[model samples]
Target: MDPLSDILSVLKLRSYVSGGFDASGEWAVHFGSHEGIKFHAVVTGECWVAVDCEAPVKVKAGECFLLARGKPVRLASNMAAEPISLQFLLPPTHDGRIVTYNKGGEFLSIGGYFTLADGQADMLLNVLPPFIHIRNEPSRATIRWCVERMRQELCDPQPGDFVVAQQLATMVLVEALRLHLSARDRDEVGWLFALGDERMRAALSAMHASPGSPWTLQLMAKKAGMSRTTFATRFKEKVGLSPMEYMTRWRMILAADRLTNSTETLSEIGHSLGYNSEKSFGTAFKRVMNYPPRQYAKL
Candidate 1:
């Protein structure tokens, strides 16, 4: 698996809930705080999105965005519109089905939220921004398939709509991340965004493929086809960390996953990740994770 795939697989999904809001004219809906990634796409018209304490953003038709953290969401046709709780707007009986605020038709959106398993969300979640805004045109072509399918499933409710909508929402989340990677119009920087760069991706893939390998800066530069100096500079600039540092972090992450899921002894886990002794592995784990392997497992 590639780096993204490896991290996603480790961050196993728990459960999902999806719903839609259709409103027209002057209106605002406040979606309360939740502990999961919230994703939504505009099906028609436009609205302003305020995730958490950040500034309001105008989301145009055909555009989509993912709220990385489970912060409160305030969506409005006008930012100043008085907020209305989604719960009061839609009774428990009609939840998950499209509900309207006032005369519906002008502003329509379909979205969902999902949570990852315990003790593993930080691998990717921590690397992402508060919200990722993916515009149409280029990104649309990449995830339009999932988006269109979701639009259909959301607009017309049928048998098993809940399950199908949740499945499609998950697809949208993954594809949206992939789309953000491919688009070149953004100013975001990090390991997640660095996957967009071809050379950086090559080096990252090498690290993910054989994290146990005794990788040096020179070896990583070779994978990226650059001199050690250039590779080190560019990797730090693009990934926000030195090449070897990233390798160590990745190894520790893999070690943590093993610690949580595998029955391997500390010595076995350390050796598998290229540590010569259990002490060295424990030290590194403590440095990166702020806890010893055994203690982390207990938590």
Candidate 2:
């Protein structure tokens, strides 16, 4: 019940590469705000990435960038170039190699997106920065490796190519978050920050590991080796939610995952998540997800 892994599992991350580009000279591509996150990698050459209200960042080969806030961004060979709409530049190709060759200084780059459809996705992702840049470093070998693997998987296909590519993309995300967490300031507050706290981590692990348990303030405080009042205050300060609220949130996410991916009955799902009855679980699910479990399962 790793907290980060649990969050990702509940979020149901779906990732795919839009296309690859081999361009040179002055070219700019605008990617509009999307429902999920976006990423770019410099495979062979260098490029500039500009997010709204932020200075342009130069990324070279072996480096990657992530946009978490669904903000519009522009990637270009030069800042002054008239940009081309990414939609036109990389038209949707259901099943093919999306490679484009252009004249000028050759620059090979890969771009992709990660989508999360879970009702609780925003709550989990709201803590992340709008943009995260991973530079080429000895410690970032795994990130570079994932990027290269994804590039090869896209450029060539074998058995289970989609699954393999998606897995590699997920690895990139995990590594990126790990790096960001390591570098984040101590004052920064979020899920990762909560995980960094010794007391909060223990309480969170307990909740995640045993979601079916009847978690209470006293129980969580004991788990954190603190008084009830101290634990409650610190938990809210770090996680931005009360203990029971976070528990309910996780329970709903777990229930949603079960509903969508399993054939288990409502009663079974509810019982597994500590709900007293199917009706109670359905009410909670509807409140959190805005739809009943039965209806959402069909969706």
TM-score for each predicted model, relative to the true structure:
0.88, 0.86
Top TM-score prediction, candidate number: 1
Give a tens-digit lDDT track for model 1, residues 86-140.
Answer: 8788876876767787768898887777788676676677767778888878547
Candidate 1 ranges with C-alpha deviation above 4 Å: 13-17, 52-55, 117-120, 155-163, 184-188
* Reference-based lDDT, each prediction: 0.82, 0.83
Error of 2 at 156 (Å): 4.4
Report the error of model 2 at residue 38, Å.
Answer: 1.3
